[model samples]
Target: MMASVYDIWGAGFETTVATLQFAIIYLLNYPEVQRKLHEEMDGVIGREQELTMDDQKRLPYLCATIQEVQRASNVAPINFVRTTTEDIVVAGYLLRKGMNVIPQMPSLHLDDKLFPDPERFDPKRHLDKQGNFVKSDYVMPFSLGKRACMGESLARMELFLFLGTMVQKCEFQSVDKDAPPKIAVTP
Candidate 1:
């Protein structure tokens, strides 16, 4: 437990900051969506009340926006590369032994099939027919399968709690009034 504590401190902070940055960027870009989230929060938690972990379930739009942010951010642009131990068939393509494998997280997140109009920053994309929060399988921001990040649950819950509360309390705006903040793209 103490082993990666040092590593986790820096890496964890980096992730949390990046997630919040993206959330702020998206909210600034789309005022309508921001207003919708604000309205939803006001309705559920009320403007004068503070948000708590229990409020996450009640904040569907806020939760959806956070998910969309993570989906769009894909912060860990380059995932750990693993080599194939033996030849395997993937997506109808045959892989050779010892071949390097790179998980294209951003590409998958932006896939039009799993997520319709993937390029658009729409929280409704994560909403169900009943307008409830619906997690997307396409969001592999923390990688996927057996090789996924170990702190996925903690990180996700932290982001949701932090961002949900922040958005509920204050109005976020970029420093530049005229120029729109750029969407962070990691190549």
Candidate 2:
């Protein structure tokens, strides 16, 4: 029990911090994206109003931006090794029961077929023409399946609250406006 607790705390802390840092860097690299996020946040959540998880639905652009950040950052490229309970065949490759396999999450996030010009940092991919947040199966930052991150819900709420509040209260900019730092998309 204690080991599981430690794993959750440590893993959650590391990933969240890395993701937030990458978010700031990405925002700096793309000021227009940051401006749009601010516009959405200010419009949905007024300057004085506090942000909550309930606001997530109303803030479509914010949601899309966060999703884009997760997709572009690829913070956790590989998930924990999961063993198959029974024999299975994936992509014509046979795997016997109890065979351990790791999911390469970046492959999905950076797939050109799924996300055209995958390297570019555009959040519109996660939004529909009507400006609604469109959740994608490919943007699995917290992994997927039964063995997915145990703290997935908690981490998501934290991210929504933290990122929402930060954008509401702050205006991030590059230290050198003339030459913005390049974003390192890899984890």
Candidate 3:
């Protein structure tokens, strides 16, 4: 029971906290993004009300920002190290059973071809020309597929709720805008 409990906390809660820290730091550094979140929340959900999953549809920029945070933070450095169950052809080479493979998440998240100007931290990247929140399969913060992180949906909901609520209530500010925090990319 204790081992299971610890696994849940270590795998999910800790990573979520780290991701949230990155988001808060980014919000502090980029006031414009913060303003956009505030505006969206106020316009769509209002200050007094709790934001729902339904409200997420109306807040494109905020949702994008959350995605950007997840991508940028790369909190879960190693996501579901996988092994082949049986012999399979992968892109030509045969991957036999017992061969271990891990997705290099940062490589995918920071790919210039997939995300133009990848280092800019621009949430607008996730937006379509129609100004809709478009999700990218490439943004695999919680990994992907059947063997992906167990807490993925829970993490996402937590991110939206906590971040939405916090931004709805308080404004984040940087004491020195010129010397904003330089968050390290976790390996």
Which model scores highest in TM-score? 2
Q: Quick one: how many clashes does candidate 2 have?
A: 0
Task: Choose 1 or 2, whichever is better by lDDT.
Answer: 2
Cα lDDT of candidate 2 equals 0.90
Scanning candidate 3 in windows of ten residues, the lowest lDDT window is 178-187
| Candidate 3 backbone collisions, by pair | none
- Each candidate: RMSD: 1.9, 1.3, 1.7
Error of 2 at 85 (Å): 2.0
A best-first ranking of the candidates according to their lDDT comes to 2, 3, 1
Off by over 4 Å in 3: none
For residue 171, model 2's alpha carbon misses the true position, in angstroms, by 0.3
Instruction: Give the Å error, residue 36, model 1.
Output: 1.0
Mind giving the per-residue lDDT tens digits that candidate 1 earns over 1-187? 7768877777777888898988888888988888998899888988778677788788888889988988887888778898888999999999999999988888788778888887789999888899899988888778876868877788888897788778778898778867769786673
Lowest lDDT block of 10, candidate 1: 178-187
TM-score to native of every candidate shown = 0.90, 0.95, 0.91
lDDT per residue (tens digit) for residues 1-187 in model 3: 9998799778788888888899989888778999998888888888898788888888888899999998887887676678888899977999999999887798888889898877777899999999899998899997876788777888899989888889999998777878787777774
Top model number, lDDT: 2
